[model samples]
Target: MNRREVLAGAGTAAITSLAGCGGVSGLFARPTPEGVYVPDHVEGMEMVGTATLGDVRVGLTYSYPHRFWTVERDGDGYGTSRVDIADDDTVHLMAVPWDPETELVLPNTGLSVAIRTQGELVSQEVIYPMLSQRMGFHYGANFPLDGDGTYEVTVSVGGLSIPRYGGYEGRFDGAAEATIPFEFSADALSAIPYRQLDERRFQPGAVDPMSMDAVPTGVAPDPLPGSQLGRGTSGDAVFLGSVVTADRFGPDPYLAVSARTPYNGLVIPGAGLSASVEGSGPVRLDAAIDPELGFHYGRAVPGLTPASDVEVAVDVPPQVARHVGYETAFLEMPSFTLDAE
Candidate 1:
């Protein structure tokens, strides 16, 4: 219920604290403290929280384990062992088990640390086992799309594990995203770096296709990369005006605000504006509005109605003209610019 708590849980910045320090603050901070957490004190990295929405106070916890274990009956006696934690988005933890006598080198106690999600799991060869290397990292995907579902996030390191279910319990407009805290450390909440897993991250040391995989996909696109999206000014965009200029619009009349802008990409309403891509591509059309401003369709894509008073300024951009099928609507400007009120 506190503004500071809301800010901490919602921002993308990493929390600075030490994991396994055995407290609330350490469990939720960036740059976890040294010598705080050990192999014996992990419940598998869990995220726990309490909240009250209206009259309903949410008191719940979710848990996940890095690896599952099944007991095998050996002639009436049972033995417990490790099971696989697959799926790429598996959560990982940093457990530096130093020699009990000394407190620096690594230990080979048949235990390791890891994080897990619904997608995949990354293992030990990638996660060095030692106190000499003591920085933790997190990777996440399958981000919650709506505020009506639950997610299982688990962290396991040095035989101890913690699990917590992060949930969404409200409605939100605009582009949706939220920050989920980690059980081992708060940095886990915001340290999830989003990189295309299936595609190449970058070029390989100035090498060409021979040394690596750099061949272009076969089906050639019409226009090469870096081509101008369209002609004319971007402020002069057009769309089918949903509201009537005189409060009596009969048919869905289209309005072109920007004189010309046609590119193959996105047109986020609040993000300045995005023109068409390849003349025809996917666009995220929204209708959230601000009464004082133009009908806010989004950051880039905007406007609820056509400019009834603003006159046409210039010839339509060829790309815009062709894409909107507006060849006949091209009328030279009698008053090139809009008059200020």
Candidate 2:
């Protein structure tokens, strides 16, 4: 079987295990059921530190080098390939940035990292926004580090590229940087829990996302305000639609669709989406950030009634990169009609 098939199966099996149980809690809980299949449960990560850059608060952390995948546009959808751990790979570096005021994790922020020691550059690369069984949505990548010592890690965050709404206007529009010291050693890296699944390793289930005290997992707001259109699933990702009339969205009634992972509800950004009402033809939905809606795709529609037949299509899948559990999902998505119940 291909890698995606293997991971999907594994996730299914893991999630099924949580059927009757009260549901596991804690950061290191095993067999953590998720919406998608994930490989094994990785242990904790050592927080390198956190810094404030512009309107974003970035938290840096590290764990054992992990094998992940890189995403690329594949025809109308997307594709992914495994990126195995290199022989010299030292740690899987992660940068989690969020809006401090809103306390929401920021996606598509164009994040990059540069590691240095003794005034010399050690490693640098533009990290990918990833979803993991441990950390739901964050920017991360594996890096080869020099032998154990204190290193100055500088994280650079770029401006907001997507449309902003509500209180998010005119914010996160400037580039910012921050530096923090990280002490790395072989012993420290080895101490982080690393377990390989046996019978359930390749099963069709996913472990639950770990509880992180340092950084909040980027999740879409539940109970999205406005008249509820309905909920549906496409390509294992859940989509929820609602209609709201607001001055910010102009005179037309706005149709908002929140696309997220199934169980964890993490936001899926960088997607090309379109919607049609009562077979009124497709209308492009722009990626938007709002105070109440969080991250969603929406547009102002002239006539949207509660009984309107709405169909939302994933014209292009999410453009963000993926970790093990999410590599195969959010692609090959079919259109789903929104039930205005």
Candidate 3:
């Protein structure tokens, strides 16, 4: 299995949505009875410190890969490509619940946590953990670390309601905060071996490699209709659509997507959409309601250049009001090189 398969096999994709704000509360409301079982310590991970705030106890582990890999922009967020950890690379902050009895894998109460370090506030989100299966929960974030030194990490967790499985509907009193210190050294980082997938678990021909051409594409309608890129598969019966930006240095490329099924194409508005070009900074594709097309459109600013190859990744939220859209995974387009105008 490649990195994508390995990551996907590790566990279920994390649901990052808020209640009421979008209609995501009900989608993942029911929790699985099978709890997560994760190991306490690994050979390479250094135990920094442990603290108990309220009901939840947190253990911070510090570790880095021998050779870092960059995420491939080709539609697959779980997939990876070759890239170096720059001088200011993000330090992996893995948060594991210290209590053996408590399953912190999926917090049903909308509990959200974030880390403050290096004068930055990093929100805790779904991060692929080391020894994915052995790590039960998805509570970690990548923070920037400058060179070798000691850094203070502060964790703050709070939510309005208690976990649904706990059989509580009242306000929760488990809000708490804890700070821990971590040290980093270049020598220690270099000594760490690369985390490789088990060769025995590798099943040849189990899954096909990711290809850009594999994604379905179409053309925009009427007037200045341009080449359109789309992913038909999404949450439930919803379909996503976008306009593959024309190769020009003018307006940034835009993607117009709506939550609709093939049978019913009623435009689902207010859905968030963002795109990123590999190596380049994040391209802001703001949402614009297109009544004519019956879909919400987001145009990329400061567009792209032609003849140069680029990989674009599109992220669509799972819930768009009542309409269920795509999951947490990104839709990666093939390496696109525009024809000379």
Alpha-carbon lDDT, every model: 0.24, 0.78, 0.36
Question: Across residues 60-119, which tens digit of lDDT does each residue of candidate 2 receive?
Answer: 998766666677866755687767667677888999999888788888789999999998
Where model 3 places Cα greater than 4 Å from the true spot, the runs are 1-43, 65-87, 98-131, 160-174, 195-198, 204-341
State the lDDT of candidate 3 residue by residue for 1-341, as single tens digits.
Answer: 22223334444432222212121222233321111111111223456676665655666665542222223334533334322333344455555542223322222212234544575654344343221222222244445565677666665555423112122223234667777777777666545432332331222111111111211111122222344444443332234444545333135554444343222232323334454433566454454322233224445544443322333333543222110111212223222221123
Q: What are the per-residue Cα lDDT tens digits for candidate 1 across 72-181?
A: 33354333233333433223333222212211111122232223334443222223221100111011111111122233333222321111011111211112111223
Best lDDT goes to which candidate?
Answer: 2
**Scored by Cα lDDT, where does model 1 land?**
0.24
By lDDT, the better pick of 1 and 2 is 2
Candidate 1 segments exceeding 4 Å error: 1-231, 235-249, 256-264, 271-341
Scored against the true structure, residue 17 in model 2 reaches a CA lDDT of 46
Model 1 residue-pair collision total: 59
